[model samples]
Target: MIKYIDSYDFFACQLDNQRCRLLALPWEDVLVAHILPRLPLMQLFDLQRVSKRFRALIRLFFTKRTTFELVGHHVPKVAFFSLVKDNNVLRKLLLESCSSWLTDNDLLPVVSRNPRLQTLDLSGCNGLTRHALVAVSLTCVHLRHLAVARCDFVDGPSLRSLADHCGELRSLDLSGCCRLTDATICYLAKKCVRLTFLSLAVNENITDESVEDVAKNCRGLEHLDLTCCLRVRDVSIRTVAEYCPKLQSLKVKHCHHVTESSLEPLRKRKVLIDVHPPPRRDRLSLAVDCGPYVNIQPLSARLLPSGLNADPLRAHMNGPAKVSDPWKNHPSFPPVMPHLQSPSHLLTLHPSCLVLALRCSSSPSLWSL
Candidate 1:
């Protein structure tokens, strides 16, 4: 059985293929799990070598959930076609029995039958090519939340399949999918309209144009991560604000072209956002001075640009605290408030008196806070 892979999800080669597997049970016994189509992959890996009869039985395990589970657990008739309720959460569908059981053609039947499976985690399934993705997309109608993080052998065709079928897909992680190109990303954007969380950290070939596609197709997307993508720029961030009105978080570390203006939308946006930028002038850093709106300081922002000084910043930061007692005394985490435009707009921190910040003052940017 496959094991030890998770992060909520990692952005790259998520499941390590050390060429060594550590399952607690005897190998031969697992393949014969009482169930067929829905047998826990952990059990099926045990019986493949027993005989030709077991091999034939294993082939049948790739059918409907009812048929698969018949050999193992009984499914309630009422739950036959239940759909996933959480559009944001990831799904887990076991296909292969184990790494050793993997072969070029072994996973075909399972792939052909698992249409609309939300999360098909064939993580250590190194033997599968991009073709399996095509098969799954064609069958899995509820297909959303896909994670092909480490199956390096599967390439663009896998993405092509997901794009073709899983239009309602919400979360997709392509962290170690290094071979992807803008054409593939554009294809995904056009089809996946409900995508909320997407991770494409190490896909070095991607650029700001990919962000354009995400914004246009997935308007409700809440979290977007481009951690190690080297080509992203301000146009990408701008596109995000314009297209994904529900966007709540963005991560763009190691992207050299990004700057403070990349986040100018935060000042105008009605929603709160979590952003990871280029250390300096990142929204995360700005969050410290704008906490009433649920802002957290940027993870980086070690040094302000040449002309900015901390004293003016300190004074600007202190201005809001002086007038907004609620924010000054509030707990570290607070409930989200809509219509929030700035640190001072939060209902929890409404000002008792008018105290306009000086336009030319030392902390003109933050002093008004």
Candidate 2:
């Protein structure tokens, strides 16, 4: 009975050893196809030092991966090259954060390899020059969305090269590229007619001509940012309002000449603008001219059309329209002061009081009769 029990125990030990030796799936297939691919790019570097087999598997994994995004990673030049050297099938390469050290030599090789790239975001890559831009334009013709924002080294000729080659570009962000001028923008507008999202923000060189050209040519433009473009005026805004029917959002912040007159049409169309429309100068001028003696009404009633009488206060409100004596005509209207009948009484008030009264007119409660 003791010998039989020893044999059974020995058989059980052998079975357990066999089970441990044989995996459910092959190790190579499991690591290369499943595990390595799932691991983050940075972790793969640590995993590569595990063994020769792991290093080979990581290389194989990168060769099959379609997207490589390492935003804000302080990747060394050598490490960046090593990670991307094996990756040739990349469709989207986003390395915005590595802008500090990323150079033409490091980027050109990757751009050359990945001809099928659809989106490339290298925003803030000030280290790169027009050579990098030219290389990307000439090589990655399939690019649709490209963001080189704050890459001030990019010049007009490289952009022209990009526009010429990548005509199918849909979204392009050139914000903070101070070297770009109106001519570059015009050429881009003419070539990239399929653009739906564009930004020329922070470039003071951008003027009404370029903006108007973009509005007319890129009618499909949905999102446009012209922030800090001081030269962009009301004319270009009006042109945009007329031409860009599909425009969804517009950013004209810091545009001094772009007033409510041009933006009113866009407002009516429900297009979202980053800057709030300035108060109508006409209304404020009229208010100031009327002086402190006039009875102030709700701003809404003052802006109402001559035919529209929706405001209940319209009957009592002392507005701009020349009306007969309301006290005699409408019994409900309050009695008129002596100053209401004569305009000369307004000029008698001190200049400081007039200024204070104008400021107070903004609030109905603070207004003096």
Candidate 3:
């Protein structure tokens, strides 16, 4: 119903002036204020060919454009230039879809024109190199929210340039940017102290140094993502929990070194984390389940006679080895005496009693003992 109504209103302006005069509202006001804003960006170009009146009205609409979002759309070069031609008051420019063709030359002019740009989301824009970011840092000083996710070509220098210039940045997403290192992150943490949300997910190079700096410098941080950061350990997580009191969400998935020792405290504070704490177990059950501790030192075969067997000692030192127990079916030993049966029983027996038992078992007359 809405599409039909909009279609009718769109074609109504194409009619002769005498018919347009019959309408209650003015044609230009209706098209510019109501009709033009509803039409797709590409449709506006076709509307321009309708008449000189529409072309002028579309241009006027572009002049007042504040937010131009073409996310996931395959915008052609010529069409993109045409859409942003007269738009200078833009506050937000989201061109995540134009990554395939968006180059520095194509984006610089728009960035230069819109100095008041507060939010720019160019995530997955792999074709764009650091030059685009440099231009943005220089031109869009008011930039507060920036997302360059998966843009691996973005290096430390470009980020340093951004941190030095855009001190007001609040939100940043650098996830999957493998080229970035700890130096870049630490530098950004100190410079962009106002950052409230940051993601370094899938970047294995970042460690405790960078994260600790971020936690200390960006104390106002609310959300952080460290997913797949294999080098990140408990120290960094503990630092984050200590420094960032405002932290509401933390993603530490796939960080193998980060254990419950650090995460348990954050759980107490009610900070949402991607990983779960380990289940509790009593110390006695844990110790029994773990079995006896052994410190087996490496032995040299050169020190022993060639015919001598060292396998039994090695097996004994490293704890029990699976084998047929010679005393199990012996007529002198009772099967009901379970402690004197298996190799595992050695862990519980006293050293002197074991020695005495072995000595007594050597003689057939004392085997019953």
Candidate 4:
């Protein structure tokens, strides 16, 4: 019984010694090296709530690697607010579709902290305005890839500020920014010489002049989207094909004036061009004038009765209603005799009558007769 008691006490002592050794070890180092890095972003945020020590470790992790992405529609606002509330080492921040909880105020505080941000994507964040973009441009001078697509409040001045500050910008997407004009694009083209990918889709005010400027200045451009830009014409396309040699993909969908002939040069260069079909003209407008014979039956309609008992030479001078399939029925004997009983009947008709029928069917207006 005494040996059993001694064994129990010995086991308890070993357990206590193990606990002491673990407590003596640097848990913060363990967390920073192993456990924290494995945890996902949400779990890391949750760890910050555990204690001041874990929060400090998270801050250390942020300092070590400045790239942070807070995307998703349901990401709690508090998560972001807490992240940027006190820290400022973030370099790449992407906040997409978080507009519900992410307001301009929340974003400004974060932006003010991360002055070295390189890649920022606030796409679909409608709450952002020109002021926010300007702040980003002025503060984040190293920005390279900026996407503020669908941010309606961004205008020429905001873009100019961004171009002026972030001259190294390589990719920019301002799609659906209705207020942008040629001036904004021209400024960007002049400043952002390294731009490779640009999307200015749905900016109706941008004309061929801006595209020409882009072709001239942004020689490094590879992909460009000018979809729904109605003012762009063949001249701009030809200019781009001639100048932007590195151009690879070009989107001119819904630009009615761009013709297939103008895009042939780009095709020769192996550029991927996306062009929508030209708007179709009205069929009635394309109809040829039939002159006085406009009342003549269409070529598709039966010009005479087709039966063994039917008169071969009798011409039917019926109106459009009497014409049987205007599309499929052809005038039996070329409009000459108006009616011919057979091939031998052509010799019997007067030469004038034959001439009149031929003229009627061959008339430009009666081309469809």
Q: In model 2, which range of ten residues has the least summed lDDT? A: 349-358
- At residue 221, candidate 4 shows an lDDT of 90
Alpha carbon lDDT at 285, candidate 3: 16
User: Candidate 3, which segments miss by more than 4 Å at Cα?
Assistant: 1-10, 13-35, 39-42, 279-369
- The best-first sequence of candidates by lDDT reads 3, 2, 4, 1
TM-score of each: 0.49, 0.70, 0.71, 0.64
Task: For candidate 1, write residues 1-369 as lDDT tens digits.
Answer: 333323312212223564432222232345334323243443444444555654445443432122222223333322222311111222355433343345446545544544434666555557767766676677776876666666676566778777887787888877778888888888888888778989888778899888888788888888888887888888888888887777777777777777768686754664443444235543422233433223222222343434433454454345553322332233432332323245445433322122222223233133223
Q: Which one wins on lDDT?
A: 3
lDDT of each: 0.56, 0.77, 0.78, 0.71
Give RMSD to native, each candidate: 20.7, 12.1, 13.0, 12.5
RMSD (Cα, Å) of model 3: 13.0
Candidate 3: tens digits of C-alpha lDDT, residues 157-227: 99999999999999999999999999999999999999999999999899999999999999999999999
- CA deviation > 4 Å runs, candidate 4: 1-38, 49-55, 276-369
**Which lDDT tens digits does candidate 4 get at residues 158-235?**
999999999999999989988888988898899999999999898889899999999899988999999999999999
Clashes of each: 27, 0, 0, 13
Sort the predicted structures by TM-score, highest score first.
3, 2, 4, 1
